[model samples]
Every structure is written in structure tokens, then in C-alpha cells.
Target: MRHLSDADVEALLPPPAEALRLVHDALVALSRGEAEVPPKPTVHAPGGAFANAMPAAYPARNLLGCKWISIFPDNPSQGLPTVSGLMVVNDGRTGAPRAVMSAGALTAARTAAVSGACIAALAATGAPAGFTGAGLQARSHLRVLEALGHLDVTVYARRADARAQLMAWAEEHVPRVRLRVTDDAREAVLGRPVVVTGLSIGLTGAELDPSWIATDALVLPLDYASSVGPALARASVLAADHVPQFEAVRVAGTLGEYPATTTWTGSLLDQARPDGRIVCQNLGNGLSDLVVAAAVADAAEAQGAGHPVDTGSA
Candidate 1:
């Protein structure tokens, strides 16, 4: 087995546009039933922390994989990353495992890719964008948003330091785009054509006023139920990576108080798409991880980013 660190995956994965394209194709394949996405089974810990298993098979990409990740919200206070995980890729033809690699970088890259694809497909170009919680997801969204050629952005976060840091990073990395920091989340989010927020998952999350959303803006709430309140979810046209996952959970009576949603059935490329204030709160699909991890595994095979371990030693 070959092992790839997060750095290796980063160096090997393609640029943002190419990354977005790859994941977009995977999602299309998913909607067409060419992929298998198992429900993510999360093991809950105390203090709202969790670890989950995400397994997927991307036959179109000729790979199967599983990513095991842990999200401990309190880790940051302990001077550590909040999310950490690894992915295992297998040969599509055979059941043999191929590679194991850190998934931190892969997660961010593919998420940005998926969010970018959503924005490109649903959002209008050259319009203002806003980000309501500045962090990794915010940065990832910005990277792909820049790739989409829409750069005028307003950022809002409770922490002034985080907002300032993101603005500085954008100025240095995406100088062509204009960046503004705002103190009011309502001011930053309400009227923007594109809004991205990373408030994360929680049961007691503060309720949001849905009227803040523009009539036609595309809101990508990467954080699941936290950023988007139930009011917005019930009001907007909803989209998700995999409806079956949520459906299964809902059927099992585990989706407590989750707003009503219908799974999106059409292709990601379909011309007749959802209109009005659209919300994408995709329950994270494992197939996307397999598709992206497979790419890094292929690159690792070619560039020798990781070393092969002798099976006999195991």
C-alpha cells in the first residue's frame, strides 16, 4: 500500500478549475446512478464532536474508497485542527486496497470544487458575493469563486481578526478581485448574488431570518444545518449532493427537526434548474471523496509521492 500525506496530495492534485471540473463530473455520474454513496455514519462524542465513515464507489473513475474523519469542534481551542482524517482507495476491478492518504487537503479541495460547480451552474456571473463565517471553507469558496471569475466579495465574521486575515490573504492571492470586510452579517449576506457561510453543524444554532437572502441568490451553506436556519431551508428551493442519505436518516427518525427537502433528481448540467433563492445543504457524499482521492492516488502512482508497503509484513 502507498501512503500519501496531505502535502503530497496538495502538490499532486490539479488546479482549482480542473479540480472543480473533476468533482462536477463525479456528481453528474452520481445523479445518473453510476456511483454508490453510502450514508455517512457519524459517531458522536461529548461536546458536539464527531467522527464519521464515508465510503463510496466511483465506477466511472475506476476507483472505490473510504474516508474516515473526525471533527472535534474543541480541537481548535487545544491548538489543533478541528477536522482530520484519512482516505483509503481500492482498485475498481479488484477488491484490493490501493492507497491510504491524509484527507484534510482532499476534503477542502473537493468541497470547494463542488461548491464552485454549484455557483457556476446556479449563480450569475460578475455579481457581488459574500461570505459569512471566515475560515477554511470561506477560503476554499473564494479560491473557486475566483476561478469562476467573480471576485467582488464582502466578508463578515464575529471575529474581526479572521475577517482581516482572509481579506489579506485574498489581496495577496487574488489581487484581481475586490475584497471588503463588514461587521454586520446581515449586511454581508442579504443582498449578495452569491453567499457562502461555514457556521457548521449544531442543534442549538441560532435561528436565522430568511428574508435576508436575495430573491435569486445562490446560498452555499457548507456547514449543513447550522448556517441556514430551518426557516430558510423550508422556504428556499433546496439542493443536495445526495438526497438518499438524508432520506434514509429521515426514515430512520434520526433527522430531528430538519426542515423538509426533496432530493435533486436531474443532472448537474441540466438547463432547467431550480430558481429563486436556492439553498444547497448537501449531506456530504462519500462518492466525491472517492473521485478526488482516486485522482491523487493516480498521481501518486505516477510521481511516486508515497512509498509502497510490503503486504507480507502486515
Candidate 2:
């Protein structure tokens, strides 16, 4: 079996544009009910950090994969990353483990690609757009927005400290994009026809002013797992990366009540929307991970990337 390190994963995966394209195509397939994805299950215990296992299958390619991700939100105290994970790729036919690869980079890439897809879809509608949160995911979305289209991205965070830190970093890295630190959610949401929220809203329970979202605007909440759905129920167009995943979480009783005109991400790709409010909530699906994992593995193999596996198992 091939093994890929984080560096290898970074080098092997497709470029941002290519990854976004793949994600767009994949969403189309998903909306057509051509792809298969499983719900991610989480287990938390006292004295232990939160961890999750996500598995997914691709029907078209006959592939199966899983990502084991853990979030030590307090890991910063140890000078470590807040999130870490790995992706295991397996053969659908024989169930043989084909590769063990880094999931962190893949996660970033896939997350950015999904954001790109949503931005492109929403941009097609011609409306004022804004981006909330200024973390790694928010930066990734900015990169995607730069590559695919143009949209005004605004940064909103609970702490002035975090916002200042992110703005300094942005000035050094992404100064071309319009970015401002907003204390008021209303200021962040007002007049923006499209908005992307990349923070862990589920964990923070941050609420947006209902009046800020114009009746004609569309809100895309990329982090849906921890999001309170009822707050966004009034949105006219509610699009999701995967309806089943949302339902699974709903069944698990994790998501509270939210009303929306339910539509899949695939639907956006298949047709065009003229107007009306559209909100796309991304809980993230395993199939998205699997597609990205396979692409990374293939690139690694073709380029002779990754660390040489030692016979430690032997």
C-alpha cells in the first residue's frame, strides 16, 4: 500500500482551479443522485478530545474511502493545529487498503472547492456578496473567489483580537480583496446579496440579524454541522451539499428546526436561478473527500511522491 505524508498530499493534489472544477462536476453528479456518501459519526468522552469518522463511496468509480478527523480546539496551547486527520483509500471491489494519506490538505482543498462552486453558482444570479469569518477556511474561499470570480468578502469574528490578527495576515497575503473587521453582524450582512460564513457557527452559536439578509439575497453557510437551522429557515432558497447528510444529522437530533425551500447543490449546477433568496449550507459529505483523496493518491503515485513505507508492519 502507498503512504502519503502531508507534504506529499500538498504536492499531489490538483491545483485550486482544477480542484474547483472537479468539485463543480461532482456536485452535478451528486444532484443527479449519481454519487454515494455516508454520514460522519462523532464520539466524545471526558478527558478526550473530539474525534470523527467519515466514510464515503463513489458509485461511478466504485471507490470507498474514510477520513478520521480530530479537533483539539485547545491544541493551540500545545502549539499544535486545531484540527488534524488522515484519509484511508480502499478498493471497492476487494476492500483492500490502497493508501493512507494526509487528510488536512485534502480537507482544505475540498472545502475551498465547495466554496468556489457555491460562489460561482450564486454569482450567476448577480447580487451583492460578502464573506464572513477570517480563518483558514475563509482564506481558502478567498483564494477560490479570486480564481473563479469576483465577490466582495467581509470578515466577521467574535473577538477583535482574532479579526486584527487575520487582517494583518491578509494585508500581507490577500490585500487585493476587500476586507474589513465588523463588530456588528448587521453591518456584515446588510446589503450583501450573497454571504459565505466559514466559521464553526455550530460551536459558537453566533447569530445573524434577520433584517440584514435582504429578501433577494442568498446565504451560504459552509459550516452547517454546528449551525442552528431555525435561524436560517426563512431563507427562500435553501441549498445543501447533501440532503441526506443533513437529514442524518436531523435524525440524530443534532440540528434543530429550520425551514427552507430545500434544494441540493447539484440543482444549482443543473439549472440557473433568476432571483430570490438562496442559502446553501454545506455540512460536507464523505464523497467529496473520497474524490479529492483519490485524486491526491493518483497524483502521488504518478509523481513518485510520499515517504517510502518502512516494513514496520512486518
Candidate 3:
């Protein structure tokens, strides 16, 4: 088996432009009935953290894979990453496990790719000032925005130090872009035409005041917190990878205070194609993980970045 580290995944994965294109194409194909992406299922252990299993296949790309991504947000309290896991790819033609890969990099890349795609799509409408948020996911959004050619950017976090770190990193790595740190989340979203929120809300998801947004701005909630929030349903368009995951949990009485529906995002996107303030909520579909994992794996192999593992020994 091939084992990819976060660094390896970074080196091998498609550049931001290519990655955005791939993700956008995947989304379009999904809308057009060319892919199978099941809703992600989560397993909550006795501990506070949870693990999720996502599986996806792209017939167009001949890629098949699953990603086992675990969220141990409390891990940071123990001086570890908040999220960690691995990706497993299989032979689409033959039923065989092809590789075991690092999940952190894959997750970040795919998540960023989604942001990049959204940025590009929104830019065609008219480029916004930029987006803001604080967290690893927020960093991913910033990276994606920069990659997708959004030059005016600002980030907001509760912590001054953390915001400073991100600002410094942005300056060093993506110089052409302007960066700012603010205490007001509303200030971040107010004038910007595009807003990406990537904060952890445990299993519940995060929420932002709709009033913070200008009329008809595009909001992308990468975190599941919005799953139960009124802002999600009240948005002009509510697009999600699967209505089943939330509906299932709601049926089971585990997902508290969220409405249940079979409303798929593809349908909503089709309905609200050209105009309106839209919100895309991702419950993190398996298809996204699978496609991204395969792309990263292929990139790693071509670039000779990952380590070959002797899975047989294990």
C-alpha cells in the first residue's frame, strides 16, 4: 500500500487551478447524473469525538474510494490535530484496495477545492472583496480564494494571535493578496460578496446572523453546524450533498431541531441557477472524499511523494 503524508499530499495534489476545475467538474457531473455520492455516516463512540465514513465513485474519472475521517476536536487539548484519518482507494474495475493515504491533507485539499470552485463561480457574477473566518478550514478557504484569484481578502477570528499567524502566512505565501484581521464577524461578511464559514460546532454546526450579510451575497457554510440553524433553511437557496444524512439522524431523533427533507442540492441549484443569495451546506459527501483522494494519490505517485507501505505485514 502507498502511504501519503500531509506534505506528500500537498506536493502531489493538483495545483489550486486544476483542483478547482476537477471539483467543479465533479459537481457538475453530480448534477448531471454521472456520479454516485452517498451521504456521509457518522459513528459516535463513548468519547466526545466522532468518526465518519464517506464513500464515493466517479464513473467519468474511473475513480473509486472511501475516506474514513475522524474528528477528535478535543485532541487539540491533548496537543494533537483536531481532525485526522486516512483514505482508502480501490480499483474501480477490480475489487481491490489500492492504497491507504493520509486523510488530513486530502480533506483540506478537497474542502479547499470546493471553496475555490465556489469562488470562481461567484466571481463570474462579480468578484467580491473577499471572505473571512478563523480555523484550519478558514485557512483552507483563504488559500482557495487566493488560488481562485480573489485578491482582496480579510479574515476574522476570536483570537488576535491566531489571526496574526494567518495574516503572516498569507503575506509570505500569497503576496499579491491583501489580508486583514477583524474582531467583528459581521464586518468580515458585510461588504464581501462571498463569505465562507468553517468553524467547529461539535456535531451541531455553526451559525451566523443573516443580517451580517449584504443582500444577495453568496454564503457557503462548510461546517455542519448550519445543518440545524434557521439561517440554513432561510437562505435563498439551500443546497446540500445529501438530505438523507440529516433526515436520517432527525428520524433517529439524534439530529435535534432540524427539519427533514429529501431536498438534494442539485435540484435546488437547478432551480436557483442565476440570481439570489444562496447557501451551500455540505454534510461532507463521500463522493468528494473519494474523488479528491484518488486525485491526490495519483499526484503523489507521479511526483514520488508518498511512502510505499507493506500493508501485508500489518
Note the residue pairs that clash in candidate 2: 128-193, 202-226
Over 281-304, each residue of candidate 3 has an lDDT whose tens digit, in order, gives 656666767777777777766766
Write the candidate numbers in order of decreasing lDDT: 1, 2, 3
- Higher TM-score: candidate 1 or 2? 1
Error of 1 at 63 (Å): 1.3
How many pairs of residues in model 2 come into backbone collision? 2
lDDT of each: 0.77, 0.71, 0.67
Which window of ten consecutive residues has the lowest lDDT sum in model 3?
A: 224-233
RMSD of 1: 2.1
Candidate 1 residues lying further than 4 Å off, grouped into runs, are 203-206, 249-256, 265-268
Each candidate structure's TM-score, on Cα atoms with residue i matched to residue i, is 0.92, 0.85, 0.87
TM-score of 3: 0.87
TM-score of 2: 0.85
Candidate 1 structure quality by residue, lDDT tens digits, 90-177? 8988867889889888998888888888887888876789887777777777888888988888888778888889889988877877
Pairs that collide in candidate 3 are 205-225, 206-225
lDDT (tens digit, per residue) of candidate 2 on 78-114? 8666678999988877777778988877887898888
